[model samples]
Target: MSADYDLLIIGGGINGAGIARDAAGRGAKVLLVEKDDLASHTSSASTKLVHGGLRYLEHFEFRLVRESLIERERLLKIAPHIIWPLRFVLPHDKGLRPKWMLRLGLFLYDNLGGRKLLPPTRTVDLRQLPHAEILEDRLIKGFEYSDCWVEDARLVVLNAMDARERGAEIRTRTECTGLLRGDTHWTAMLHGEQGDARVTARIVINAAGPWVDGVLDNAIPGIKHQNLRLVKGSHLVFPKLYEGRHAYIFQNKDNRIVFAIPYEHDFTLVGTTDALFTGDPDKVEISSEEARYICDAINEYLSVDVTPEQAIWSYSGVRPLYEDNSGNNSTVTRDYVFELDDKDGAPPILSIFGGKITTYRKLAEHALEKIGGFEDRSWTADACLPGGDIDPARFDSFFAEKMAQYPWFDPEGVRRLLRAYGTRIDRIIGSAADAGDLGQHFGATLYEAELQYLVEEEFAASAEDVLWRRSKLGLHIDAEGQERVADWFSART
Candidate 1:
């Protein structure tokens, strides 16, 4: 007999993980399977902002913006460690959108989505201390507004962890090779290192992201499933573009926008072109033209002149946007659209299209609503995820407490740990008497205790999962350090 479930989620992105947590919390047997690590694709490759999509205002996405803005504060309240306020300086260029237009939009943005928690927009002079030193001389004035930065990958992981804690089955590196529908449930063939297995579920959520259409193809073959417009967004990480924690939103000549945000304590994250993608999603990479376009956009707004070669690292991901037949890929709706096929009271499969990281929670709620039968028993909005029980207001105070408790360890390491693990830092270090007890230091703050905790608690199986997604120690840990981590995993495997 196949293991059965109430819902079988086909992807482990933010959407799938969020849905799993929501459904599992409501007393439903849930199984979420990912062909790769959670957030390995679009979820982790975002700009990492829980913003209201300020640019969406130009496209008149007011409802989407409002919903996102409301969720922003709510998300911050629940997971303050991974989500927090970030101020964006929007410089008014000469040829781009005028000041009056910008101010009017800002007014609407400020009022929409029941703005709270984050501060309102304020005008600043470019001739001021930080702005004068950072922005180009031509940029005399700009508007600073509130948005929030998220540890994108961590958000997905936390949701999955919470779902697992709530009795949901989260299977990573497991592919649904074939999905067979029965009269009342789905027989899903899963392929993983443990070998093939079959599972049954009353409902299936096709949140396969870039492969949403492909999942549909597996269930309903012969007919092409082409509701997606794959748009490749690429980002370049340069060695710290200006100082301070404040990020900049640069307006380009092509009526698009690019962001330069402080990243990983030692780099600036930028880029995200809207080039249409048709090839394999796994093969997505930044094109030279796109790289040059990003460099030009950076140069246009900031005084810093840079080349593509200056970037130390870059990453790219394909967004599986719902095809609205829009002329421009960038102008396509970031809003999610759902397709539910429950023809003649048969088993239903709901496929999700589009959607950004900011609204994943709400998206999950709505997905459940579309699935039907679940009560108005929603509870995630007020609950905390994993170790995010710390008061959002006391993130700093909590950090200080952790620092004081671990005075024997590097303060920087403690801060990073608290930020990454929140209250669960105790799981890794509670018993450790000193830094030496944390075990073999891989590099930087990475230790054997932390590695063991990641494997046992956070579902981290590989060194890449620990170094890249779990924490960005890949940037800090030297090559020798990285090899040691790989060997550590290798020895275990």
Candidate 2:
């Protein structure tokens, strides 16, 4: 059968976008379809850390930890603007895990992954620091370790952008309704705002994060497949809990950990409760109980007790973890698994399960290897994603240069732009003599020029795409500003 594309990828999360970029770079004719805005689910709802899951060491997931650690450094280098080093403070909880055990875990984490650019773990005397007032007095000591923080949604967008630049067709808000497999190709019926269309591809890569099994069941009915344990993880955003650049990893009585990280320059992002989820992934929200659980978990360690009413915002996502039959939801493995169905010479369908943001690129490489038609050598290891060409060692010099070039812009605004757009800032700010030239001011440094760039270059269809995913300005802007931005999009569309 003749195929319209060499590969058709379902889902627009990190994994799907990564695979599309890799496959397109490898010279495959690729088409990536998304049911909603990219990173609208689990990919965006993460704690937003690129770490070697320090707790995974307790699960004896040595390989996963090592691979994640290696990828962490690589990602920092490739996307230095959005991805940068973040130090995590783990306060000692005597009742939960002893000092010696914590020390042992930190020791292994520092050594397990090839420790390179990031600094190794070190003990801290929390009592000596001014921020000690914010912590319970019993937590006199803690350990500081390295990880990277990412603008999670931007990572997904960048991957999709790079894939599109490499000749892959990216279709957002496009749902793959049905799939019919032939001996040499698979025909997919796609329905979107534009209506329905059929796309034939030589292969199908289902990188649907939480919809992997759902896609398979709809496409190939009557096929026995591995069950996915859908675990809902939720987070809460509160006014800055502490005044520090470092984030905190708190230990709870249930042996689960919650992170309170600095967010949006004005708030603290804390969260993540693991409860077995049975509802639709798209409709998942932070339940009141989950919100109380998060507050209770962090309250045990922080001096300032938190209540649900104090929460400014919250989010939840269902992780499509491969069913490992673990007794606890928190114990589920974060490693990815690939299932390939290619019986009787029919076109292959490779379905991905259980992956994290840190290991997405490697997962894509392995996915292509499993599908088999691509060149054996991997190329993404050294290639930088768009706007990520800055030298990690000299990011300061680069920012200084940008400020010099855009003297008319506010220093803080330029810094924010550099972080979000990196070298691509020029494209957004192009030839603007001053702030007024940047067009209608929506709010908080967001301008019409930047919004246009997002709609045209990136796949941003509406205002929330710009306010939330493309940038976290939603946290800063008020209702009036948000409504104005929405009106602008509505009038234009």
Candidate 3:
């Protein structure tokens, strides 16, 4: 039987969305399905930094760090609106990782990826104004380095949107229930909002992330495909802890690092405990222990002390890391590995094991190359996602232009839109002379127009999808406004 698509990609997370975008750009007929919203799980739950993993130097994962560092600049260039540079302060605590050693690692990290575009690491005195009042007395010395911040969920959505524009079919709220291999093609059973349908494809890519093993078992029965080590990373959102745009990377006595980042204007994002997780990925939540650990880690470096009860919001996601049999969960290799099963010219199913957001574009390119059908090229590196066509250095100019163009709208709301939509801000504010022209007021800066644009362009089906993932408006929008947005969706459906 003939195949319905050149590529059938399962999972709508960053990896799968990226693969769909790249493959479709190469002229492949692609179909990508997700059991939930794009980036609803791990992709949306990242620490939201596009860094080279400075600590990875300890484990000596040079290649991974190098690739990530290189991608850091590339991503910033391509998506300047949602991505930009931020400084990180790594203090030299006396008892852990010596100062000289830290210098050596920073040196390597600085030069590893042909460092350009971002500033290099430099030493600093934490005794200075910002740090003196914020951090502990002992943390008098530190090094400040650069990394880019990303709207993680927006990255995934933009990739999927780009793929759809390139002729790929992206189906959210769609699940691939089963897979059957054949000589020339594979058949998949899909259960989605419209009901069940069977589809065929010449190649299948299993980028299911946390559910990779489950998908593998469904594809090739009778084999226990226990290749994943689900590591749960959780984060806490607290009222602003410090007064700087710079983020802090605190080294704990346990040899782990926790980050305190400036978040959503009103809160500090602190987090990311590396604990082994065996629960359902969908129901992953921050354990009380993890929360306390994070608070303790924060207390060690910051002058102000915090308790678990003070946290306003928390989230957790399991990293579907390839089980490398490491002694510690924190030390598990983050590099990706692939499993290809195509014996004697039988239909091939490529299963992606492990990967991080920083290297997702490289991962997609490599995955396509491994499958060996599309034109092998670096087209994606040069191509821009949906609204990311502006030059990185000129983003401020672009924003200024948009602000001027929509002078009648609230300046702050326009700024937020530009950050989320980039060049596509016009799509929402096109020809609207005033705020009243943008449709009904839901709450805060959210109008019916922007919400409509999200539903129409970004595949947003719910209020949570709008306020939380597509943008962090949930932090600012009031509860009555949020409920009205929900009502608006329900009225439409």
**Ten-residue stretch with the least lDDT total in model 1:** 1-10
**Runs in model 1 lying further than 4 Å from the true structure:** 1-3
lDDT per model, in order? 0.91, 0.92, 0.92
lDDT of 2 by residue, 1-493 (tens): 4799999999999999999999999999999999999999899999999999999988999999999999999999899999999999998877789999999999989988888999999989989775488888888889999999999999999999999999999999999999998878999999999999998999999988888998999779997666699999999999988887999999888888999999988999998999999888979999989999999998888888999999999989999999989999999999998889898888999999999999999999999999998867788888898999998888899989998999999888898898988899999999999999999998888899899899988899898898888899999889899999999999986
Residue 437 in candidate 1 has what lDDT? 94
Candidate 2 clash pair list: none
TM-score of 2: 0.98
- Kindly state the number of residue pairs that clash in model 2: 0
lDDT of 1 by residue, 267-338 (tens): 999977899999999888899999999999989878779999999888899999999999999899999999
Kindly report which residue stretches of model 3 are placed more than 4 angstroms away from their true locations once superposed: none
- Candidate 1 Cα deviation (angstroms), residue 424: 0.8
Model 2 global lDDT (CA atoms, 0 to 1): 0.92
Model 3 C-alpha lDDT per residue in residues 335-453, reported as the tens digit of each score: 99999988899889999988999999999999999999887666888788878898988888887898789878887888888888889988998889989999999777899999999
lDDT of 1 at 488: 95
